[model samples]
Target: MNTKQKVKYKKNSKKKMNWITDHLFLFPTILFFLIFILYPILYNIMLSFKKMDVSNFMTGGVWAGLANYQAIFSDPLLYKALLNSFIFTFACIVIEFIIGFALALLFRQKFPGVNFMRGLILVVWMLPSVVVGVLYKWIMAGDSGVLNFVLTQVGLIEENILWVSSEQFALIAVTAANIWHGIPFYMIILLGGLSTLPRDLYEAAKIDGANGWKSFLKITLPLMKPTVLVLLMLGLINSFKVFDLIYVMTGGGPLDATTVIPYYAYKLSFLQFNFGEGGAVSGIMLILVIILAIVYLKLMQKEEAN
Candidate 1:
């Protein structure tokens, strides 16, 4: 072949090889995703539509249609769990956002220990959530809790309070621990957003006779809207999916005050052997999250368009 023809042939061969390699590289990821994630999701959806439990495992499950869903709505325990889930989610969002924003704002100014403080905060976030739960359970022990000791020394209380044992306080105690552990994550993300903001905007605001609060409201908040929205959506999702902390700290005990939806689904599946009901719960949660995600994206799109 002529040199020009040879070069053209080589280019064509290279393009074809590149296409093949790209497709081939995706095979393992696609295979694992389907096998591990997608397959289980699809299987769970199927199970949700049927009746399967310890009683009918070997004999094949029955078809329940919407009965399981109706049962979910009708069951008082399920409603209680749903309420607790919302409470936990709301508390996490409020507490984490407040603490995180404070830390981000403080750390925006250069200081001697700022980096060290940031690193220490990240350590809390890096610890496995289960480990944090277990550690807090120990710290909140009725007799020897450090919190009780400190409070007593400060004359805040006369005796050790049963933080985890009381039905009235168990959920609040667990939520507090979760807030401590989760605030770091939010702070880091918000700090990144803060760092990216234009200092010139703040400077101009100050030049134009804007005070701190005025500048924050008029410039900082509007500029940070996208980041704030992203954090809120993610924080809500993460809080709803909380399981390990409650399972370890309270075990949904003290009249099930700490039982969130994830823990409830776990109990229905493993503890009660009600696989169908658990699957249904999981499916419902999945649908709800997906709907929220779609709604958030639509809002974001509209905001961006304007």
Candidate 2:
């Protein structure tokens, strides 16, 4: 407790206080996450192992220990829904990327009303899924729908096609609506990535007598790889969790054709009152998303290191 010792103790105390103050700023966020996101996920996992329904949901139920998961595996409907989900996600991602990238490139150039056009396109993306679903549902109606009338006039078919009600086209209709809704998101992300590319590289490429395609293949694609990867990963996760759109558009389909995993879980939980199985489905989806998210993080780390 001499002069030097007293100063040293005072500095240590100040450092301790500073550390506490810094971490206190994170307390609210951490507590919010623990209470909301983490708690619900943990509860869902626990519910999957129990024999609970609306009957015993409030009281909780006896531990069933994998029965729900076993039932999920045994059901043929789950496989059908899973396959449908894969097809829907694949179609939406591919089509949206192509159209969105093209639009992004188009909008990046200076043109009359270019800013206004870009903002207008975002109106579709900003809409709620339910609203988009309803809009498409009407446009795809069987008898007097605009789509049917136009196709008939163009001689694409002799009669109106059953877009939403028919098993053959229900899934396609849902996929098309989703593609339109998601294109703006892809456009904005890819446009941001495009904006960051070095102008010097393009100038250099042009001096080397490289054509537009050549420059794009050589410079643009290579530079945009990280952004493309991240966008695709996000799109896949969002597509997998699609529910509200499907519910509003087709209500899981004419014959389960558009019933993706999320809708399947909802059908089980609310429609059938099988909470255990529904929770199991959610747990499975959560695991799949977590795995993909881990891969996304690893890829990001590698990109940063490079």
Candidate 3:
């Protein structure tokens, strides 16, 4: 070939090689995710429509039509689990917002040990969630829990209360544990959002005779709306999927009071050996979360339009 022809061929080869190099790194990740996540999700969807139990292991799973869904709806324990899940999610999100906002504001200021405190909080966030669950399980122990000892020492009560032993207290106790473990995450996210906010807004509000609370209510809140909404959506999703803490602490005990949807699904799959029912629960959760995501997206689009 001539020199010009050789140059043209080299250019084409370079572009092809570059494209291959750019996408080669993604191959392993894409393959692994498809195998691990996508395949299981599709299998679960199939399982939800089948009659799979311990006995039919050797044989293929039988088709159950709508029987699994019907069983889920007819179970009273399902309603209890749903109610507790909502209650836990609502309380944790509200408390996390208030506490996390306060913490972010405090961290925004300069103070002694501020850097160290921020680092400490981030460490808590980095800790594995199972470890957090284990720690709280110890803290809420009826006989020797630190919380009970502190309360008794302060004379708040005559005796140690069973924090996770009764239906009335189980949901709240699990929520409190979740709040403790999750607050650091909220603090970090809100702090990042706060830093991006212009200082000039607060300065202008102050100049206009707006007090601190008024400035926060009017200026800070409106400006933080997007961040707050994102956090709330994610927080609710995580709270709804809570299982480690409740499983380790209460094990859906106290008359099945602390059974959130995830733990219930686990119970159905592992404990009861009813894969179809568990898969159905998983399908329902997936649909609910997708609905939430769609709602949030619509609201966000409306806000942008206005």
Q: Which structure among the candidates has the greatest TM-score? A: 2
- Measured against the true structure, the TM-scores of the candidates, in listed sequence, are 0.94, 0.95, 0.93
The clash tally of candidate 1 reads 0
Candidate 1: misplaced stretches above 4 Å? 1-11, 58-60
1-306 in candidate 1: lDDT tens per residue?
999999999999999999999989999999999999999999889888788998897876899998788878788988899899899999999999989998999989998998998899899999988999989888887898888889999999998899998888899889998998899989999999999999999999899999999988898788888999999999999999999999999999888989989998999889999888899899988998999899899979987998
TM-score comparison, 1 vs 3, better candidate: 1
Q: Which whole-number lDDT from 0 to 100 does residue 211 have in model 3?
A: 99
**Would you give me the overall lDDT of model 3?**
0.89
Model 3: CA > 4 A from native: 1-8
Give the per-residue lDDT of model 2 (tens digit) for 1-306. 699999999999999999999889989999999999999999999999998887888888779999999999999989998899899999999999999999989999999999999999999999999999999999999997889999999999998899999999999999999999999999999999999999999999999999999998999998999999999999999888989999999999798988899999999999999999999999999998999999999999998899
Query: By summed lDDT, which 10 consecutive residues of candidate 3 come out lowest?
Result: 164-173
Model 2 poorest ten-residue lDDT run: 53-62
lDDT by candidate, in order shown:
0.91, 0.94, 0.89
Question: Residue 261 in candidate 1 has what lDDT?
Answer: 93
Worst 10 residues of 1 by lDDT: 66-75
How would you order the candidates by lDDT, starting with the best?
Answer: 2, 1, 3
Candidate 2's C-alpha runs over 4 A off are: 1-10, 301-306
